[model samples]
Target: MIRIEPRQSSSALMTYGIPVLSAIISLLLASIPLTFSGAPIGASYFEMFKGVFGSKFAFSEMLTRATPLIFTGLAVALAFRARLWNIGAEGQLYLGAMAAVAVGTGVFDVPGVILIPMIMVMGCVAGATGMAVPTLLKTKFGADEVVTTLLLNFIILIFLQYMLEGPFKDPMGLGWPQSSPILDQGMLPPLMDRMRIHSGLIIALICAITAQFMLARSVWGLKLRAIGENPSAARHAGIRVNRTLMSAAIISGALAGMAGVSEVAGLKGYLTSDLSPGFGYTGIVVAMLAGLSPLGVVAAAIFIASVFVGADSMSRAMGVSSYLADLVVSTSLLCVLVGGFVARFKFVRLIQKKEVTQ
Candidate 1:
C-alpha cells in the first residue's frame, strides 16, 4: 500500500530546488520528442540558445516578446498569491486594448504627456471592470470564479471581434479587421534606435518591483497571504476576506489589461483580433514556473519567451514544427506542477504482516 502524507514543514531547499530540477527534467523529456522527430537534439538546443542571445538584435526581440508576458505573469502571480483563480486575464487584456484604442483614436487629443497616461489609466480601468464581474459573482452569489472567469474570456473575445469588424474597424486597412493606428502621442516610445523594444519593458519591471515590495513589506500583503492560507481563520482574525480578494482580483485584471495596452501601443501600433498569440494563457505558465513570486516572474517570462522565439528559428533551420516550442513549454509546466506536489507531500509505502492469517 502507498500513502501520501503532508510535510510538517516544507523544506526551503526543496521549495527553490524543485523548480530548477523540474526545468532540467522538462528539457530532458523534451529531447525524447525531438529524437522521435528525427532532429538532432543537442544541435537543436544549441540553435535555440543562439537564436535568443547570439546577437543584439535577437536579444532585443526576446525582450520585446517578454514584455507583455511580464505584465500578464505579474497579473496571474498577484491574484494567485491571494488564492484568487482569475482565468479572465485574457478577456481583461482585450478590454484594456479596446479602451486604449478608444482613447487613442481621437477620443483624447491631448499631448503625449497627457495622452499616454490617459490611455494607460483607461486600459487599467477597463481591465478592473472586467474582473469586477467575476469577483462580484464569487463574493455576492457564491459563484465559482474559475467557471465565470473562463466563460468571460469568450464573451470579451466576441466583443473585441465586434468592435474591430464594426465601430473601430480601420477604413484605410483595405478590409483588414483592425482598429486605426494609435496616435504618436499615445504610443509607447521605442527604447532603442533599431529594436522594437519599448518603454513597456520599463513599466513591466517597475510593476514587478512594486509587487515584490508589496508582497514582502506591506501589511496589506500580509493580510492577503493570510486570507489565501485560510479564509475562515483570516475572517476570525478580523480581516475583510471578500474585500481583499476583490482588490486582488481588480489588481490582477488591471495588470493583464496593461499587457494588451503594451502590445498595441508599443509593438503593433493598432488593435487587432490576433494581437496576442496566447500571451495571457502563457502568463499562467510563467507565474507557475516562478512559484508565484513577482520578481521571479520576470526571469520566467524571459525564459519562456526565449523558448518560443528560439524555437521559431530552430524550426526554420531544422524543418521541425514551430509548435514544438509550445510542447516544450507545456511539458515544463507539467513538470513544475508535479514537482510542487512532490515538494508539499511525501510518499510512503506501507506493508501489512501476513502472519495474521497464519
Candidate 2:
C-alpha cells in the first residue's frame, strides 16, 4: 500500500525553492516542443534569453508588458486572500479603461496635474463598481460570485464594444472601433525618451509593495485572512465577514481597474477592446503561481511577461509558432503545482501481507 502524507512542518527553503526548481523543470520540458517543431532547442532558448534581456530595449518592453499584470495579480491575490473569488478583474479592467477615456478626453478640460489624478480616481471607481455588483449579488441574493463575475466579463465586453463603436468612437479613426484619444495632459510619461516603459511600472511596483506590507501588518488584512481560513469561526470571533469581504472585493476591483488605466492612459493613449490581451485572466495565473503572495506576484508577473516577450522574438527568429509560448507558460503553472505538492507531501510505500485465503 502507498499513501501520500503532508509534512507538518514544511521549511521556508522548500517553500521558496519549489518555484525556482519548477521553473527550471518547466524550461527543460519546453525543449520537447522545440524538438517537435524541428528547431534547435539550445539556439531557440538562447534567442529567447537575448530577446528578454540582451538589450535595454528588450528589458524595457518586458517591464512594460508586466505593468498591467502586476495590478491584476495583486487584485487577484487580495481577493483570494479574502475568499471573495473575484474573477471579474478582466471586466473590471475594461471598466477602468472606459472610465479613463470618458474622463481623460476633453470633457474635463482640466490641467494635466488635475486631469491625471481625476482620470485615475475615476478608473478605480469604475473598476470597484464592476466588482461591487457581483459581490452584492453574492452577499444579498445567494448568487455565486464565480458565476456572476465570470458572466460579467462577457457583458462588460459587449458594453465596451458598444461604447467604442457608438458614443466614444473617435471621428478621426476613419471608422476604426476605438475610443477618442486621451488628452496630452492625461498621458503617463515614459521613464526614458525613446523607451515605451512608463510611470505605470512605478505605480505597479508601489501597489505591490503596499499590498504586501498591508497583508502582513494591517488589522484589516488580519480579519480578511481569518475569514479566508474560516468564515464561520471568524464570524464567531466577532469579525464582520460580509463587510470585510465587500471591502476586499472593492480593493481588488480597484487594483484591477488600475491595470486598465495603465494600459489606456499610460501605453495606448486610448481605450480599445484589445487593451488587455487577457491580462486579467493571466493575472489569475500569476496570483496562483505566486501562491497568493503579493510580493511574489511581482516576480511571477515579470517572469511570465518575459516568457511571452521572448517567445515572440523566438517565434520570429526560429520560425516556430507563437503558440509555443502559451504552452511553455501553461506548463510552468503545472510544474509549479507539482512542485508544491512535492514540497508539502511525500509518498510512502507500506509493506502488506498477502491474503492467505487467496
Candidate 3:
C-alpha cells in the first residue's frame, strides 16, 4: 500500500528554489506554443524579454500593470491567511471603481486633497461591504462562502453595467458604455512626466510594506496566523475566531477595492467594465505564488505583470495568439502548486511481512 503523509516541517528548498525554478519552466513552456504558432521560439522569447526589460517604456508599462495587481494580491494573501475564501474580489473591484466614479466625477466640489481621500474611503467601504455580505452569509447561515462570493461577482458586474449604461454613462462618450472621466484634480499624478507609471505604484509599495510589517509585528497578525494554522487551537487559547475572520475579510476587501481606486484615479481616469482585465482573479494566483506572504506578493505581482506585458509584445511582434500569456501563467501556477504539494507531503510504500514461524 502506498500512503501520502504530511510533512512535519517546511522545506527550505521549496521555499527558496521553487519560484526561481517555476519561472524558468514557465519560460521554457512558451516554446511549445511558439512551435504550434509557427513562430521562431528563440526570437519570440527575445521579443518577450525586450518587451519587459529592454526599454524604459516597456519597464514602465510592466510597473503600471503591476499597480492594481499588488493591491489585489495583498487582498487575497491577507484573506487566505485567515482561511477566508473571498472569490468576489472582482466584484469588489468594480464596486470600488463605481464608487470612485460617483465621487470623482464632479459629484464633489472639493480640492483633490479632500476629494481623493473621499474617493478612496468610498472605494474601500464598497469593497468591504462586498465581502461582508458573503462573510455574513457564511457566519450567520452556514452558507458556503466560495459559492456566495463567486456568485456575487455576476451580481456586481450587472449592477455596474446598469449604472454605466443608464445612470452614469458619459453623455459625450458617443454611446460607449463607460462613465464620465474623473475630474482632473482627482487624478493621481504621474511618477515621471513622460511615463505611464503613477503615484499609485508608490501607494502599492507602501501598502505592501505596511501589510508585511503588520503581519510580522502586530497582535492581530499573530491571531491571524494562529487561526490560519489551527483555528481550534486558537479558539482554545481564547482568540475570537469569528471576529478575527470578519476583520480579516474586511481588510481583504478594502485592499481589493483600493485596486479599483488606483485604476480609476491613477490610470484610466474613468470607470468601465474593462478596467480590471481580471486583476482580482489573477490576484489569487499571485497570492498562491507568494505563499500568502504580503511582501512576496509584490514580487509575484511584478513577475506576473511582466509575463503578461511581455506576452502581449511578443504576440504582436510574432503574429501569434495572445492566449499564450494565459497558457504560460497557468503553467507557472501549476508548477508552483505541484511543488508546494511535494514540499508538504511524501508518499510511502508499505511492505507487509509474513511471519515464517506459521
- TM-score, cand. 2: 0.95
Candidate 2, which segments miss by more than 4 Å at Cα? 349-358
Q: lDDT of each prediction vs. the true structure?
A: 0.91, 0.91, 0.91
Q: After superposition on all CA atoms, what RMSD does each candidate show versus the true structure?
A: 2.4, 2.4, 2.0
Q: Relative to the unseen true structure, what is the C-alpha lDDT of residue 208 in candidate 3, on a scale of 0 to 100?
A: 96
Q: How do all the candidates rank in terms of TM-score, highest first?
A: 2, 3, 1
Q: Judge candidate 1 against the unseen true structure and give its global Cα lDDT, from 0 to 1.
A: 0.91
Given candidate 2, what's the lDDT at residue 294? 93
Residue lDDT tens for model 2, 177-286: 99999999899888987999999999999999999989999999899899999999999999998899899988999999999999999999988888898889888878
**Tens-digit per-residue lDDT, 1-358, candidate 3:** 9999998987788786787678679879889889989999889999999999989999999999999999999999999998989888898899889999999999787898998889999999999989988988898998999999899999999999999999899999999999999999898889987998999899899999999999989999999999999999999999999899999989999999999999999999989888988899999988888888899899999999999999999999999998898888888888888888877888889898987995
Model 1 lDDT at residue 88: 83
